[model samples]
Target: MNPDNAATMVAIEIQQPGGPDALIPAERPVPSPGKGEVLVEVAAAGVNRPDVLQRRGFYPPPPGASDLPGLEVAGEVVAAGEGATHLIGERVCALVAGGGYAQYAVAPAGTCLPVPESLSMAEAAALPETVFTVWHNLFERGAAVEGEWALIHGGTSGIGTTAIALCRLFGVKAAVTCGSDDKCAAALAQGAAAAINYRTQDFVAEVQRLTGGRGVEVVLDMVGGDYLPRNVQCLAEDGRHVSIATQRGVTAELNIMDVMRRRLHLTGSTLRPRSTAFKTALAEEIRREVWPFVESGQLRPVMDRTFPLREAAAAHARMEAGDHVGKIVLTV
Candidate 1:
């Protein structure tokens, strides 16, 4: 583990975006930290849906973002660049720009957060991406408040589970939709007020029933398209629906009448495309509002599985399977 050694590292690369087979293992030089960044000896990296999309070539990293496939990682800082005074040799979990799929990754100093003492490296790796996304969408954009009702699609997902836990901690009531009974039970155990099995029940109707026909105040949706119209229908007046991904479909026949009648606001965003300044602000918010909960053991990341770094392709395959209850990690 000499800092000066240019170690051979294995990374999952996409030769041609298509399916799970596209994620091929390759040997490459370990990257060095640049100004205001730190080079981490990655202990673990989280496998996210965006990584899967990137592998398929449907989504490419934003300009200056990492060309490799990882979005978040937890590891020990092996080296720090100029101006990165606080992070040398520190164990941390960070929201990465790219390059997380490798054995080593460089992260901006400001986006790195101290790992909770109680968390495993695998759990720490799982936190940054889903926690950041949920915080940004639910509290920042959706303005989910105490006592307000929040609806989340894919309730058993990493983001969904994180959102449900945070909402419970903050006194927000959450109703989530999952595909299976076991997933519903998992979401409920994580503090979702109600869980609807989407395969067996109409989520809109179930939400209506759960909320006493008033609808929820916020909706965090990843499945777009058909969910779009029903998301509007399941909103209270002035509800905000934030779409983070279009797993279902992008386009939808929106009933403008529902939009006008409910005054619902539909919005969406991607984390990688945001400027460093924006990401810094998000980091600050997490530090101020969320980190304490993590530090105190009130909010813990849900990790369902882990794969060795060399098994990154298999990790991606697991995520694509869509049966996982929480985050998946690649242990380096």
Candidate 2:
């Protein structure tokens, strides 16, 4: 494929590992697609917790990944690499390891999915990371069955809200825990069966109460540390608990008797370091199981706020403030 006219694109670069102020707008060379990849002219990109962690130097990009921070994007494919010629000119959303915080980015051909025309680029931008994550951890790993009760640890986070929506769409009962009453109300409005105020009430008690004292079938946990033990307690017999992040702390201890008695499955995964083939398989699973809901509007992207591409520092600041209820995005 031929290159675009411009040699470089406006992108966000982390000057150093520190605060959000480290995110500076700068010009960088537009990247070319490799074999089995597509070069996309990005219209918008999703801001996620991993991006913030990377900016703060806690989470470094995997080997050979872009240094730029964005993990997901919505854009038009400008060119395709060998054996991926079908992607050119397609408007799609993709889960990228990095390099999304720019005017142009390259994504694995297998990771790209068609965006529904009804949604804005901003909404589509918000899909890849959250959708793939929820699908992987919540359904694929956690085995959240339809008509079963599930507890989500962070109700208003990008991953949490998407989990709630997908659970509701798939007929699983969803209960979430958030820091504020407003967030609880927001979760309820998004089709969550229940929302617990984690700041005040005990989530274990709330989950028990909401599930009629029977406990839930699955728990989608992002807050690790002490929550790990409590997550196991929140589940029913033969239950599954999946961890996608360790927001509170990394280490925790659990009761040996709890697992033996309940037959619980404790598992966790980090998405960024996985192989392209693994992500490609996940993309296919999402296409068959989740994309219909997205395209039909049964499930919707919950976008809380958006900032200009240049004001990414401000966006990160807002995210750190902990007030927004849904996905934060940057419009290019």
TM-scores, each model vs. reference: 0.97, 0.98
> Highest TM-score, which number?
2
Give the best candidate by lDDT. 2
> Model 2, 234-265: lDDT tens per residue?
89999988999998899999998989888888
C-alpha lDDT score of every prediction, in listed order: 0.89, 0.92
Which pairs of residues clash in candidate 1, taking residues 3 or more apart in a chain or in different chains? none
Off by over 4 Å in 2: 1-4
> Model 2 compared with the native: what TM-score?
0.98
| Superposed Cα deviation of residue 308, candidate 2 (Å) | 0.9
Q: How accurate is candidate 2 locally (lDDT)?
A: 0.92
